[model samples]
Target: MNRVVRAAATVILLAILVPLLVLSSAAVGPAPRHWSGVSLSGWELPLVDARPRQEPGTVRAPHLDAVTDRLIARGDGGWQAVVPLHDGSVYVETTRLDPSLFAELGRDFGGDRVSVVYAPLAPQVSPDGGGGVPAQTLWQRTDPLVTWATLMFGFPWQLGAALLLTAVAYVVAARARRRRAAGTAAVPAG
Candidate 1:
């Protein structure tokens, strides 16, 4: 094969393989466990009541056993939660807490009752909860698949820059080719 064809083929192959590698690696570990009908203590209120939309909330275990950072979201008529573990792993869960449910529960019970389904992503750091290493924020630790997708599809600026560079290169090449042809035509036949 020609050099350009070989280079293009290599680029295409890498583009396909890179995402597959990232996704498959993300699925390597044990699946995350799910819990249902998790009861919330009134003291746990600080943990669950705060809205993830505004900012992250902090929760210390009722017995002061451990500290956890929590993020809660209630939008699109649904609810979601994210908690990062000490080992740089993350737990993501979602619940369907519609407005009607809230109205039925009223203000008192609304914050106490919930059903959660959670999964643990790969740990980015070792499991050393006792170590002095500070806990990582939700932003620092995220699922690999989510990270990969964001890098692949979310940045419009990168695509725009690439297109601009390609256009400039094409124009420069065209001008060079024209100059070469004109020079050759002006010379007398040997």
Candidate 2:
């Protein structure tokens, strides 16, 4: 009803809304294009140099070895090497054949013979009913309700600071109004 209350409400609302809007906007950026008809069996490993490839030292994929075994056993006419990228995505290198082990798969190193499949190392339920695999997009990977819950209730320090700022603003405005009223009251009822 008073200016102080209005100002306090505005401050609190802005404090809450600004961060929410920013995070939501970031999360809502253009939806990633999903590859249709893609299955773990169909994905192939890309060709790299003869140097030994390394998985990321941190964040190992729990099911990666199993998936690799399946891929190798399937003999799906593609070479598959699972290499972890710097950004946490696993690049499964797929080629038609092993260059050294099985020379029959074709050794043409012109880059056209290799295909790279990208997915996060985190396990996720398959959206296409093929089986569980790492999710390809933020929308598919994260539970919406859980994310909202964390955003609303998590980060106590940030919430506390915003509340403190709101209270301070309210107190300052109220004190100023009171001082003005007291000054006017002393002025001979003018």
What TM-score quantifies how close candidate 1 is to the native fold? Answer: 0.30
The best candidate in terms of lDDT: 2
Error of 1 at 130 (Å): 13
Expressed as tens digits, the lDDT of each residue in 1-190 for candidate 2 is: 6768887878668556534542333234321111221112122113413222344464764545644555555443232256544434333444221222222211321112222332222343322353534434544343344334333333344345556766787799889999999998889943
Off by over 4 Å in 1: 1-149
Give stretches of model 2 more than 4 Å off. 1-146
List clashing residue pairs in candidate 1. Answer: 52-72
Question: How far off is model 1, as Cα RMSD?
Answer: 16.2
TM-scores, one per candidate: 0.30, 0.34
The top-ranked prediction according to TM-score is 2
| Lowest summed lDDT window (length 10), candidate 1 | 34-43
Clashes of each: 1, 8
